[model samples]
Target: MNKAQEKPIALSIRNLVKTYGKVAAIDNVSLDIASGEFLSLLGPSGSGKSTILMAIAGFVTPDSGEILLNGQKIDALSPEKRQFGVVFQGYALFPHMSVRGNIAYPLKLRGIKGAELDAQVERTIDLVHLSALADRMPRQLSGGQQQRVALARALVFDPSVVLLDEPLSALDKKLRAELQFELRSLHQRLGTTFVNVTHDQEEAMTMSDRIVILRDGAVQQIGAPDSLYNRPSTRFVADFLGRANFLEGAVSSVNGTELKIDVKGIAVRHAKGKDAAAQGEKTLLALRPERIAVVSPDQAKTSLNRIDGSVQTSAFVGSQYVYVIDTPLGTIESQMPAFEAGPLRQPGAQVAVTWSPEAGVLVKDK
Candidate 1:
């Protein structure tokens, strides 16, 4: 299998509470991290993600809570006893130490010397593909190479878990993507629990097995990436995970599982997921830009939810052309594939946007 599976849970945090002066950095946070699972804590700045990571690493003591490692309480244990490897944004490599010495630091501290230290260091260096630069110092290596060194050092000690705090934020976009692949590959090969904290949605979605969304120092929602993206529990998650266009409406009626709502002067239909909206309740329909289709008015299908609008602007953004349409429901954004051979609509050109009822995400107005 490509993924690490069938292992037991590795860590559990119950009722974790922490405060800084009058601010609650983390409030009643509880999460279970599975063994060999890659989970990410995603949020905006000050959403308490880094605070949660620090609490897990035992670097920042919480006001109250119990942290359990493999069912044993570890709140009173120090960071060294936790045996969790940590890699931060800056890499934090020892500038005076060579790559081999850097990777061997933790082992050497435990009195592992001679051929054993060499074997361990060489093994980790091979894991990170740094054999060519094993003799280079931190200042002599590039940003990506230094990141690999940090990763190698973290893994060389064979820690029970690894906590990464914006580990790839220092690298450029292309290099970050490359490192993301290497990180995931390492996880699969080693089968170690990895907890990552980041504000970047794409990075979390790309590398994590599950994502926990946080807002204002509390849990907003937690689930698989696609589940959270397609069926967000609230407006914040739908907007933050990706670009979404909101169409406000009041619930007119609910027929069994389907919902009929009134948007502006038009009646729109949407399918409910898990929760149904009450009649007369204000709700917002969150539709993704790429989920919309722009077609000629004559060719619009009857089964699709169709809206006629004038194209306000169209801009080519790499692989897709984003079009802003001025419809009765205010402004809506639609993305069409850039390489597709079709008639390009100009500003002021009349067009129709169509999408299935399944594509409409019904989110509470709050």
Candidate 2:
């Protein structure tokens, strides 16, 4: 088991369901968050990621089911009573409040005073690297700085859990990337249970120990970032987590731990997974673009599953070259590192794509 799984449960959501009119915003979702584990609720819009976070924070009441914190049910607790720090999408800093004042507000609300409040505020500000700008107003700080201030505010009270609702979505791409690292580092340093909600796949994969993928109003899959990305259980997950090229075929034969599939009359070999299909059963294989290697037809290895194709198009995407290869199976996307892709293949260049049997993950056709 992973370290997170070894730890005790910090929070648990059991049979959580919420609805509006006839639509269920959050279906019967159940999850257990390990102590100090950074978990992300990730999905597209209207997927109930935010609703689950809000329910945990006591802001949204569930239609049914219970929320337990450290084994104690807290379904009746108010937002403030829950004592969970929340950083909303908007920084929501008070215009009149200085950095120090904003971070101190939480303490003051709890009746903390004088030296105690000031010391806590200063320490949290320093933690977020905003000590130099303690007196600056929200308008005076850059977007990154403002985000830090908001994070400082959340950490000031030293809550057991911190909920972040797409906290870095408002920043530019570069700043967002920088903050993703910083936020992940902060979570580690603080060792606080963090439940983050976001629609950005990269952001969730970057900062989360485990990701809960939701669709519509239900949980689709929950697992470690690499596990979910590599062994996605459904078509939506395979497509959502990253760029995946799916090969549809029927299992022609099973040889020990491997299965040979027939894709458009060509035999495709795949390593058997837990849900290995029976012979003659339809199968769908999820192959990541980066797993495919483009080579000259003569250079293809017999041990690997090889498909003859011609480069339909190729685009250089900084670190890698993404190629659209037209093969008998269908159009397949391949990503190769720029340094190793050799000379770029022009349109209609005859090439063959090869990948190990293990590279093709068996996924539910759905």
Candidate 3:
């Protein structure tokens, strides 16, 4: 079992349901967040990611279901009583107060004063590497610095959990990437159960120990980043987590653990693991672009699956070259590492795409 599974449950949502007017914003969703695990609620806008986060923070009351903390239900508790630190998307830093004051506010609210509050504020500030900027106001600090202040404030009280709602969404790409690493490191050092909400797939995959994917106010899938990315249970997951090329076909033959799918008369070999499709059953294969290799038609075909196609379009994307290949089945997208992609394949160039049977994962059509 993974470390997360070994840890005790810090929070649990049992059959959580929340509705807005006639729409169910969070539809019968349930999840267990292990102590010290960094779990991200990931999905597009209006997918209920934020709604679930708000519910956990006690900001939004659910119509049904229970929110538990350390095995005890806290559904009736107010936001502050739950002792779950929250970092809003806007940072919500106190413009009138200095960083030290902002960090000390939570402690002050609890009647903590004097050396105790000062020490806690100082320790939390240093924890987020903001000791030097303790006296700076929110307006005087950079976006990243302001975010650190917000985090320090949330953590000062030593809350049972920290809830982040797209905390890094306001920063630029480079700064955001830098903070993502820092935030992950902070989580490791503190071992605090962090429940984050985000729409950015890369951000979710980068910082999460495990991710809960939601869609249309309901849970879609929940698993470790690599597990969900490599062996997605559905087409939605396969496409949402990363770029995926789908091949629709019917199983033509089954040989022990291996199965062959007939895609427009082309035999696409697939490995049937636990969830196997029966022979003649319609199947959908989610193939990652990076798994496909574009080679000359005369190149030796050692892989189980190969298809002849012409490069429809090609573009250099920093570390990799992305190509759109037009094949009999459909337009297949392939991403080849710049180091391995010897020369750019021009449009209309004939090529053969190859991938191993193990590379294609069978996913539900839905």
- Per-model TM-score on C-alpha atoms: 0.95, 0.98, 0.98
Query: How do these models rank on lDDT, best leading?
Result: 2, 3, 1
lDDT of 2: 0.93
Runs of candidate 1 exceeding 4 Å displacement? 1-6, 273-275, 301-303, 341-343
Give a tens-digit lDDT track for model 1, residues 1-366. Answer: 223335677999999999999999998999888898999999999999999999999999999989999999999999988989999888999989999989999998878999999999999999999999999989999999999999898889899899999999988899989888888888989988899999989999999998999987899998888889988878899999998999898889998867888999788888776657889988889999998988788878575489999999988787888999998888899998978827668899888888777888887655
Winner by TM-score between candidate 2 and candidate 1: 2
Candidate 2 lDDT, 118-204, residue by residue in tens: 889889988998888999999999999999988888889999999999999999999999999999999998899999999999999
Estimate, for each residue in 1-366, the C-alpha lDDT of model 3 and write its tens digit. 667979999999999999989888999998999999999999989999999999999999999999999999999999989998999999999899999999999998999999998889889988998888888889999999999999988899998899999999999999999999999999999999999999999999999999999999999999999999998999999999999999999999998889999999999988887657888999999999999989888883676688999999999999999999999989999999989779999999999999988888989988
TM-score of 3: 0.98
Off by over 4 Å in 3: none
Worst 10 residues of 3 by lDDT: 297-306
In model 2, where do residues sit more than 4 Å from their true spots? Answer: 273-275, 301-303
Each prediction's Cα RMSD? 2.1, 1.1, 1.0
Model 3 lDDT, residue 6, Cα:
93
